[model samples]
Target: MGRTVRVKSFELVAKDINDVDVKLLHALSIGVGWPHRPKDWDFLRRAGHGIVAVDGIGRVFGSAMWFPYGHEFATIGLVITSPRTQAQGTGRWLMEQVFERCGDRNLTLNSTHAAYHLYLSLGFTKEATVYQWQGEAVSPPPPVPALTAELSSLSTANIGEIAALDERAFGANRQKLLALLSEGAAISVLRRGGEAVGFSMKREFGRGHVIGPIVASNDCDAIHLTAVHLRDLAGQFVRVDTREQTGPFADFLQQSRLGINDTVSTMSKGKRFLNRKENEPWVYGLAGHALS
Candidate 1:
């Protein structure tokens, strides 16, 4: 006679993120209070490569993903571990797996408060703070400073027009990511002397819409670039993640009713990630915490 026996423990192995059902990944994010939907997970799968920690029966317990901009750099994100597995080194194990796969590439990530110490132990240095501003968009937004540049709609076919400027601000050639984000997104470009000086994109993400990757040389231009999109999304749930703490740009967002929701620390390994110059083009708003 034989009877089934229950096991008290099980081992987990790394599996390709794409190999699992999208719902599983969605559930994994939701388990940790993250707002990623199935669609969002699918989009992330297309945007980069990732891995999930799963047991023999395919029950996922943790996940880690990396978005590579080039041979020398990549952004790590979506690192999540089930609550039951916390304090057991699952998070660090998943990170080590990502490190192995990433090789010697320089890495950057927006670390939540809970994971800050872990990252510091891994040799990541603090760079900046990313504030997540989100709420119901105001119809008129707020009054902006006088316009100094011509604002115009930019077609996806002409994405190359802003590639150089974006590279200058982001410190990487991520035109590929920009093209993927431009799919079904509302894109606007700021021009002076017939040259593209700044640009922004509003796209569907998370609970509602996100206006981000706002690139500009100063606060005023950033305000105008953001206001143009807020004007169209009035009364809808909108979100923007930015590193600007205090300035005309931050004030404009506060007046627009998008209050600060949460913040994450931007950390980097191998090289300094953020370099703000006096008047050079800067990333006023990030595409997403994960994508940053």
Candidate 2:
């Protein structure tokens, strides 16, 4: 079933995203200057549910997706409208569709500059700014701070080992999303006294590898967790989206050659999505801008 929406002269139909061809979705994202590869789109399709705005001829004009972590919480992302249709109400219509489907769940999303006003007008409050950092991983990535924990490789088979810690940092039990992200991803975990303290995952995304979902109790540990992967990715493209605007962890990323590329505002429609506490686990890096 689909609903027809008039955006200017064209009548766009909201179709189930799963039914649309992946190539069409890729083209839609490309038209908006996003870096989501077709494979990345496919992975996201598997991670959540979405809808695509299509026309009578089957050309997609927009898309929106929501990842529900549990019965009462969800993160909305991947919302895009064709540049040609910008400001004609297509984006608003698409968000309305997402709202109808998401029901009463507490919602959050990282809004791009173009969509900030639209989201704010719809009742989303700004939470924080996420900094997108990326560059060729430098050789011998800035010296690590004094050794305080053991860093080791983590296999997906033992994903449960860090579930509790990740939930603590992210404010939800995203074990399922972590499991999906774990596939083909290089994982590293920081352990102290034989107990897992923090972890990070490096995976193929967009134009290069993204190291993220980095969880730690402090800036030093977060740096070590991220550096463990950066060291292995020397000379390769790496990206990390973090909310830490200023701190030792942010400084370390700059020293590692990951320059700030862009920023997005984290907005929530219900309960606050981010909750950081002293000496408590925090997300040093995000899994992805949309996935956050």
Candidate 3:
């Protein structure tokens, strides 16, 4: 019989809030073909929990990130394994560490085809199927009267306001995450008569761009913001994730002929603490590929 592989005894290092290792983590994530940015690390570190697997020789074998919105709701992402250590259970082990650390929280993750089975085995069931419309021309959206609201870019000056709006849109207080986004990613806010109404953010990736967390006060605003952001992409391809619940926006995507490229099932396990409103416009995109 073949020899059984012995589980490696690795130390799980929880990164210090706003630690510099975030840069290294971002690099590693990108190396694994994930769409991420150095600035994203700041957001993940502040708005989420991270665990790094360190071997006896002080080498990092794998890492996982969990972004929490409140006491019991979190979106997990950035699960990466060193190329040399793939299939060694490093990814699974890192996930176990995340579950152990955030057991009381309802977790969500957007798993790739290769990892979907692993996530399903962990009690995460399919909730919604996601699609990507890539390689299409980025056309400007028609002007809508309801979207005449003022648009603002997220910055340190307005992080609190941004966080409040985010909670209203996503149903949880993610102030720390806002702070991180302000630092690492580009965030745009839509305001009507100076009141925050919606927001969206984007992170750079090797392939192209992923737009998300496109939350708005109405369907029109969501479409306007998505069009504005997609227009900026111009020649490059863009990927957007729409939920089945956001009826209006989902309808818009369908009618616009932004055909589905691929889909992912949004699954969950454990009780969810945050009450997600069905009325809020569907999320046209998420903060990142991982968080979406």
Q: Identify the leading candidate in terms of TM-score.
A: 2
Of the two candidates 1 and 3, the one with more favorable lDDT, higher being better, is 1
Per-residue lDDT, model 1, residue 69, is: 90
Candidate 2 regions with alpha-carbon error over 4 angstroms: none
- Compared with the true structure, what per-residue lDDT tens digits does model 3 show for residues 1-292? 1111234444434332343366667667767776566655665665666767654454555778887765787888878877866677667777777887786888777777767888888778776666665454345543434557877677767768767677666666767766665564567888878877788876454366666778875677887676666667766756667654346665565544456767666667776433456566335566665665
Q: Rank the candidates by TM-score, best first.
A: 2, 1, 3
Candidate that scores best on lDDT: 2
Candidate 2 structure quality by residue, lDDT tens digits, 72-127: 89999999999888878888888899998999999999999989999999999999
Which runs of model 1 end up more than 4 angstroms from their true locations?
A: 1-8
TM-score (C-alpha, index-matched) for candidate 1: 0.96
Ranking by lDDT: 2, 1, 3
> What TM-score would every model get versus the actual structure?
0.96, 0.98, 0.73
Among residues 3 or more apart in sequence or in different chains, the pairs in candidate 1 whose N, CA or C atoms overlap within 3 Å are: none
The ten-residue window of minimal lDDT in model 1 covers: 1-10
